[model samples]
Target: MHDASAIPDAPTASSPRAGHAKAVAACGLTTALTWPIHDILDPVNTVMLFLLTVVLVATRWGRGPAVLASFLSVGLFDFFYVPPRWSFAVSDIQYLLTFAVMLTVALIIGHLTIGLRQRADEANASAKRSQALYTLASHLAGAMSIENVRQHSASFAATQLHAELSLWVCAPDNTLVPATPDDAALPHQAGPDVARVMHMVHHEHKGVASHQLADSGQLVIALPLTGSTRSRGVLLLSPLRAHDPTLDRHRPLLDAVTSLVATAIERLHFVEVAHQHQIEANGERLRNSILSALSHDIRTPLTALYGLADTLTLIQPPLPDRAQEMSSAIRDQAMRLNRMVSNLLDMARLQRGKDAGQLPLRLEWQPIEEVIGASIQMLGMALQDHAVQVHLRSDLPLVHIDAVLMERVFGNLIENAAKYSPAGSAIHINAEVQGDTLEVRINNDGAGFPPDRLQEVFNLFERGMPESTVPGVGLGLAICRAIIEAHCGRIEACNPAEGGAQVRFTLPLGTPPTIEPESEGEDRT
Candidate 1:
């Protein structure tokens, strides 16, 4: 059989008054059992029975029931089981020891049992709190937005603690305000003191409670949403009461919730920044495509018009001197426009990796003087006002490159020098074979690029000077860079030791292909 004394009592639905009556009846029954077992009830047995009642009352019912059980045990022992049966009087002097021992044991047991049960209840509550925090953190970790996290957190606090809840977060602009409730369409606003506490928690990484708010009737718990070495925001919970005793007891759980929110907010922030960068990159690409189309479609007809005007100027028995001069001027201006359009098209092709002609380098042995003379002939018109000088090493080995593209590369560089330098300035072109590589430099005495603008000068459509004053659209240097780089070469610009800008490019050296020897006995030789 199950021992009645060992079983914990079920929770009672009785009022405090009715519970007192039930406890008295239980004490009376135990006294009666003592009377039957011993003709004269043993003081020790009465004491033991009284302790049992106190233990049951404390564990299941709490302090009120334990006090009632204590007093009832003393009364029952005196009336039913004491020396003078059925009376409040005792016949034996030793029976006074029985009464004293029974009452004292009842009081002591009531105190000790109540203290132990209170401690056990506290432990159970702490464990439940830890579990709640774990659940909240797990949910928050998967949340994507601050609003979602706040709503879930507030709902958890409200349901678990049985209180109305509100969460206040700090905005990027550093304003502390309460989050609106879902049920109501109205906005939630925090008072001055509440806002102050929220800000303090955010900046200091400290917790603040509702009582800290001066006029707020609700208990506000401010928990900091903090990260490693930084405080991100604050979580403000407004519970129904001035202070929920249970919430105070579970402060650690609330802190865990705040930490989870902080981590989620930081992750979302970086994700948003990355998304914005992608959007901007796409916009830049689209803009570049539009510019390329405008340059090509608009300039094709202009090139044909310029070629016709030049042909008409050379008509037999040319119309008049003035008319011929006007045609020549129109052709020159049209040619300039043609060059700008070609630059745009070339840049577009280079960017899209569609120019396969630039690959499969053709190597050959060619004299440096011959290459320089060809490039000068192509750019003779542009360099008419400037004096051109070519300095080549007598022992310079033949450099390897695509002859057609390399001529264009040299022509563009010399043209750029002439355009930037003064009318009478001397533009020097120098070439030499420098151990396994060929170095070519074009220098001019003119105002050099600003220190900060040196690198920017090579970007597509990036002009060294304003377009209204300077002639070209800044595509010359960019084309120069592209052509040189395609030849497995490098180019750079810097100020010379004296003054002016000097641009240099280097190409790797390659040996000429060997030719077959003729047979000595061949009569044709």
Candidate 2:
């Protein structure tokens, strides 16, 4: 059960008639008590007792009541206590002075007492409002869903203001829909033509508007639900009791509640958005992992098939020309499939990266030219139609890198260049040490990457020439970027002003071990 007395009475507008009645009743009661003992007390003592009654009335009520009480006390004192009983006319001039002093003191005391009560009431009201807002904020902060916010806010309003309320949320299409309450703790205040009220609130952006709820035949108010960015919805509240004084007195608290509810609703909205994005991200990761595994598993069988096709061509008994041609075709197809599988595997590995806790690279110091040569040799027949040109500075420095991974990076770039360029075009490879970095450029005479899509080419499964007849899953450049980045290098694709696609990559030029000149016949370590 609630401690009803602890709940302070809300401040309200004073009624003149009610104040006057209270003042008369207080004066009458004081007169009746002192009449029997009029002779027992002197004039000064009698005045003091009446003044006390006036002060009590002022403290309990307000300025109007106190002022009325003050005048009534003076009139009653003059009529009964002054000489010549029951007469308005005073006989002695000295007694007139007494009446004058008594009235002045009572009025002054009443005014001061009323001012103090007003200040106290104002302070108490402020404290109550602050406590209510703090409690509402605490409840809102922990609320995770729209439903939780609605329930908490509704309960708080009903308890604090005795107001039955309903919440309406804005739909994505800017329409309002009722938030159905699940619990029966409080009654809903749905008004007829709720849409009209909501429209007015949204368009006006005003504080609050009053409307009659059809269900309860009570006055209901609509407050706009607004967040930091924009208005979200509307809140409807109806005082449970007819002509409820608490509603008008506590309008500020309701405004505060509206603000809190709007903020909570927006917060919940964004949380849901983030949750959806997380799900999509997880799904994408799972898909990539599955595809990577399938590609990796297919690579071994494709390699064996390619070897078998090549072996058929070199059979001990010379095969027919047709059989040889078929074997060549089989070997070419198998090789192409094997290359695709390798790209997929590299793409998967790079995508998963440290997220799967893979082993770190076996980094070693090696000559950059060696990695390039190994990459070209591995491509074998792929670059058969292209002329490969290697341009290395005479004093190029060795780079610290993972040799195998570096080979894969070079292989992917070379393969990409060969696949895009004309069959007989030259594929240029340039390498040199510039300052503390070793920069390498691979250029081919082909349609360069589109300007708009230059950056996107490095994204997994994104292709430079998406519409081209080139057979690939668009993982080559992406894998190249991953491998280069793993070595603390940077790779970029751009079209040279002179024409053709040119890819430039740079690796840090770390200090290499020097070979000490061996004494004659010394063993090598």
Candidate 3:
């Protein structure tokens, strides 16, 4: 921040500040020159010359000087220019009338001249300030970032008011940090006290906080950068040498400055957000395009490969032991690859469904246990090594869900549990009624998920052990989350205290249609 000093004033600024001495000198000079004109010129003509002197002083100097010149002209006219020269006494009473008229005319001309000059100076100052404001708005409109905004603002402040400035922008959490990254400290290098004040300014959402340094009487102002939607931050202006009256007078200019700055900053903020969103949107479209194209392209040949391998073992005359094992291995790898491809296709489909604002659901009221059983049957051999346990309360309520999609959810979770857990470990499935929803939990006694990555595991391609040689590309949990959310349910993963990972999901228990019993008196078909 720079030191305080006022900007250069224009030409008219000097007029109103004229001293009494200058006014007296002008009057004295007029009288001395008129001493020579006393004998040569008529007394009335001499009075006219004195009146003109008063007008010049008023226009050049200001109101007070003009009034002083007015009085001096009258007295000098009475003693030196009247009939009884060098004396205050008058020869003819008519000359007294001349003196009275001269004084009255001089005062009126001086007063009017001074008022007109002051008005003209005021208008010029206002126009200059308005032009400065217009220039500032132009610069701010083209500002690329907060740094650019602060730079232009500081330059304007220096040029217009001779002040120093810095901008502190608000973070999402309502904390203030320096808008300029070049600032070596956070909100304030000045300390926590100043930081608190800056935070307060941002929180208050309106008005400026000001203080005058006792030593230098320099004005420091903290102005809120309030945008249309929110308060963006604070703009700090400091070390203004202008006194209280000047600040009060220029307060509107400062407000307009902050308003312009706030508008520019918010525009930049949204532009950055829009640019980022566009990039993400482009990337997502590309990923989905690749996934859809590859999945469809590979599925045909992949199915043929799996069938050929399965046929090798089923032939009437089996191949040699080594050949048989190789065929089995080939079949197993193809199945794994097929599952991966199916996952990619499903992911792309779900993404498209979400963009269309709804998932494709053939929803019905069905027993959740049926979906669980179907999922286990579908993954028959995969869960052979793990003991599967299903614990459902006898009074479980029917849930409204897409039966096929729910089955996929259970299957993905069960298979994921088996893949991540040690062989022969029990994968626990439990369901119970909790309030208006049915809560279900799938637990596996593996090392559990990484404590820090429990939530992240559900993000696409975020594996629990990223570097570990897991046989998955980490799509199962993400798919599960998308399905559960589409059903208007909630899902979360956590490590249970029992030393294993658990995925819990809840499905809403809607009002199921009543099932009427068969009427005993029904007519025969």
Candidate 4:
């Protein structure tokens, strides 16, 4: 919450009774000044002089004073300047009509003059309001941060509305809190009942005159700072007086102020978002460079280590059985490490290609069954303990894909299935045609994926169980997703009703090359 409590009040108008007293004094002065010239000028001229006085009073003192001046002008004219002077009676009956005409004319002139003056005052107020908003916009345009927005907007509110403000900006978590806790205004006044205020702001998207919400009985108006896309925060404005009439009177200005504040806040939000993304992009680029370089450097050593370990197992006398077993284990571990490094290198290449708006895929028309079978054969000893099943139609169509990458996807899925499920658990692969797409599913019998995090499992380095004893980095599924999406396919993870983790992906089906029959006539020719 950002609070501006040190603002000074603007100048105000004089009291009503004092203003009316001045209007009466002006009328008395008018009668005294016009008395000396009554005989010198015609009575008609005298009546015109009184009407002029009424107009002046109406222009200066507003409606109430104008009304008082109108009645006083008539009484003073009949008693002092007209026939049967110093009395309410008029000797010539023609003068009675004069009295009626003079009084009626005076009241009408006063009313119209006062009304015209009011409209003038309203127009001036509107001009002043426009100028103030323009000044505020100028100040906010230069604001670079939320704090700058707060200080400039609060200063504007203080000078124009004669009120202080508290700004509560929305946090990234979608929670509304004070812009700065240390700067909260009237801790006893606004902070405690914030929950109620924020609820009205977030849901209703308007200001609420929450009169009874304050602890010290002060009124707090909660104005929602709503931007184009969402609510930015709440701006709490406190009027100068409790139950102040001007609170409602100045509501339009208050709302205008809220809109300006919301706009500034929104601009700052997007700027921060862009800055964060830039930082992350820089970090990601640097990380990929390091990983790619390291993968290339490490791959050669790992291949040499695997070959050396394999050669040791086939030594002349074949070493001892214990030595032979150790060599085999060393060979397997080196192979696994080499594959991991290769995956890292592949991920770097894919990321670079993605940055260039495409993937480096070597596409060809290949049988889906052949790719799946090749993947299974590549993971031979890894799948020895697990039962693997493949269910594909005899007439399954050829698919356009990057055979190497697709094989990697299948290999990763099958290896993950074998690693995650209990030893001897069955891994199932099935495929079917749906519309113009072929859907393939790989499932395993195991403690299924965490239900809540099904989609997050495919994010780079994200795993179903982060702390599990699985001995592989979580790149397999992520790489699979990247490769599949490059082929214009979609992938999803779920738990089947039979209780196991399942990953399904879809590839579009299109016309394949027609196979020509090599008939006997062609063979003889």
Candidate 5:
């Protein structure tokens, strides 16, 4: 790697720098050799030789060495090449001007040359580091597992960082462990408290920490392995020289290495998560298929059982009072079971990937009030104890929807309210045309949803009161959301200001048809 800091600082007289000595000696030797040529050439031409020496020193080294050569060149020229040879005094005032011009011109040329060299060195170093970073990133992108990340990261750190390297991964239990267990015999052993520091860095997700190693007392740096959102782990580098000046200069390269490693680790993490999700999805699909098949088989027998129970009450002779009551109970339980079966079947249909995308729905313009009344009647026994109040705007527009599915939405919401609310508490249904859409709300005067769990109520198998005697696997609200969204609408649940649970949904109010009157009796002839 090219290090821009390798260019020497300004030379001081107290410090015996080798470059300064070399510059001064080269200029002095050239001046001595030019002494023999002094009688053969003009003194003005001798100044050219000294200027050439200064330029060479400046290009090869830097400003410190170039400055030394400049002063030495002028001194040698005045001592030997001037008219009064072997002396500092000048024979003519004109020669004094020559010495001044020679010194000034040499210093200026040396200064410019040194600046150009320094800039070129900096550009070259930047390019080299950029290439290194690009190469590391490419390799990291191909990394498929945490082990691959560990190997690539460690190798780059060892080669480019010039320090002993180790990657510490934050385990699921929050313990810090070596990225590769087998590579534990590396140079530095971390302190026991290093995990605490790693945890702090990962949680803060900012800044690097320097710690003293336990066994060797060597300084090591711990930088957070930051993904796009969270921290992955910590990168620990050891055996960095104490008070090293160049370490700060290479910080950007170190940061690039951290970014590449963090990204690789995060990618591997999500890949594992996706694989697990796919497996779970496959299992869920199988379970739904089995439930759907069983529900289909049971529906026929359940219908028969309900019919036979009702038939018992219709015997030629009037049945006994107890028998009539038993038949009513049987019918009610049968209806409840059938509703559950229908919900499961609806879930299965909605969850079918190809069906949701390709299956057509039976949709038409219909009155929302009709769907609401049908849902209430379907749940007659269930909501018999609860009072239902309907508040609808007078000019409610017709909504374009699949009537059967929209009825299901109202049924689920009303049934959920009836089940959760106290007996005889009123369930309120309200609707109005708001702009180009119709918004409907169903609220129950009962204990509202638990704090901050309004959205969780719509997740499959999630319950508002999980431990309560309420009989549901929590698929109702999820189904309702799916149906409403399929109609290009939105649904939301919230706690009302007056203490109750409110579920509101909306659907587009499409343009209604207009009928025209026929002309009076024109076609009678």
Candidate 6:
């Protein structure tokens, strides 16, 4: 909202129209005749004509014509109505006092009347500005998009200021990125120096004007768009003339427009960020639902297969050699199915944070080699055909973690490496302590992931090879991320220089506990 009294009224150009001139001439004629009849006409009547002439000058002829009418009234009074009529001499000194008092009164009244009129005009202009600002604010508040707001603002600015205007928004690097101006002939491209000037004004929350622009038949005014404590961008308005009074008069209104634009841009930016977060949350929920359905539908058949395989192995007569092979195949297939179900259930549990009770972290002085060996032993079947190499340092310190979850972390990574790579490819697992954290790298000799899918691969059900004929549901790496993040760690995937994908993760290393000295033995020392 704008204060009406703060707005400045613009001075209109002096009108030279003939009708106004004719009206002033008519009032001057009537006053000339009435001044000569003071002896026949009442003195009040003569004073009334003089006052009427002052009103005409003030309202129609302005200050110059009004002053001229005052002198003409004095001349008419002296030449015709004063003593010794039709002569330049006065017969009485008392009449001189009458002349002096009337002239002084007329001049004083004219000056005061003009001043009051000027003040009234100023007030009216101020009221118009307040209305314009209020209307602009209302229209912008209901805008649905930044484009709509920009267009509305641009048009309003041009119309109100009577100047060609352009708006530039700030890029991420705080550079002035100009919007496409409505006028194509005007240079829409802002140069490097112009951008620098705009940035300065935006940072300083000030206005910018240069004589270079003024001399070039164009005047550029950079008004900073600031909202609250943030500077949203800059508004560049180009007026036609260097001394355009209209533009100068509307400076406050322009500031109000810039403020409104800044507020809108900030509002729209937050709205977009919130919308994106909502989409991610919805996607996470849908992925969990699908995984749940898959786990339930696949587990029933797998349990039945496991039971039938065990029954076949215990046939009354020893099963034929071929039958035993078939039974073993059935059991292996059932185990693979069961592992898939377990992966789904584990993913659901990890995403929901339901496994917090199962993986209680116990801090102890334990060798990195021991933890690595435990993880490998659990993934033995998955890595049966793949050559696994460990590169653990002998002097590596023990890490504090939930031993069970850490094993699952390594199990998932190694399994993912194997699943993506061809059978017999070497899978290298290395752990090194680097500056207050332990960095683990799992590298394989398989075809690397597509560059575009590097980050997407971690999203649930998003596979590096979306159309691959692989057996898993693409939840392995996502589960790996959830568990690692739960442990206050970070993980990322990249293509290695050796033509395979490398998955790296970091875990913070706490101080290893020192072994307590053995208490004095119960046996005699």
Off by over 4 Å in 3: 1-56, 79-86, 91-120, 168-217, 222-234, 239-252, 522-525
Better candidate number, 1 or 2, judged by lDDT: 2
TM-score of 5: 0.66
Give the CA lDDT, 0 to 100, for residue 360 in model 1.
46
Prediction 6 global C-alpha lDDT = 0.74
lDDT of 6 by residue, 1-525 (tens): 233323343435554344346545755687568755666897656766876777667766566666666666666666766668787688888878887877887787778777888788778867676677677788788877767777777767655675556667666787666655453233233333555677799889888865354435455678888877577778777764445666665677777888888888778777888999999878877777788888988899889989899789888897999999899889888988788788788787676563334433454555767777898898777788898899988788887776777777788888889988989889999999989999999999888888988888887777889888877777788878877777788999999876898999998898887878776865655
Over 94-181, each residue of candidate 4 has an lDDT whose tens digit, in order, gives 9878878887898899899988987887787677667778878877877898788878877776666656677888877877777765
lDDT of 1 by residue, 245-336 (tens): 65665576666667777787777677788999889767756756886889879797997889899997989988698999989999998988
lDDT at 255 for candidate 5? 83
Tens-digit per-residue lDDT, 270-326, candidate 2: 888899999977986997889888987898799899999999999989789999999
**Number of colliding residue pairs in each model:** 1, 0, 0, 3, 0, 0
Task: Candidate 1: give the clashing pairs.
Answer: 210-220
lDDT ranking of the models: 4, 3, 2, 5, 6, 1
Report the alpha-carbon TM-score of model 3 versus the true structure.
Answer: 0.81
Q: Which portions of model 4 miss their true places by more than 4 Å? A: 1-14, 24-46, 71-93, 134-176, 182-201, 204-238, 250-268, 303-332, 513-521
Clashing pairs in 2: none
Query: What is the TM-score (0 to 1) of candidate 2?
Result: 0.72
Which pairs clash inside model 4? 1-178, 1-179, 1-180
Candidate 2 has its poorest 10 consecutive residues by lDDT at: 1-10
lDDT of each: 0.72, 0.82, 0.83, 0.84, 0.80, 0.74
Tens-digit lDDT string for candidate 3 (1-525): 122223344445565455567888988998898897577888778888899999998888777888888889888889888767788898899887887888889989998898899889778777777787887899899989888898888777766765567788878787777888654343221333455566778888766544432234445567899988889998776544444335445778889999999999999999999999999988988888899999999999999999999999787788999999999999999999999999989888988888789999999999999999999999989989999999998878889999988998999999999988999899999999999999999999988889988889998888888887769998999889999999999999999997989999999998989889889898868
RMSD of each: 9.8, 7.6, 4.9, 4.6, 7.5, 5.8
List the candidate numbers ranked by TM-score, top first.
3, 4, 6, 2, 5, 1
Give the C-alpha miss distance for residue 287 in model 3, angstroms. Answer: 0.6
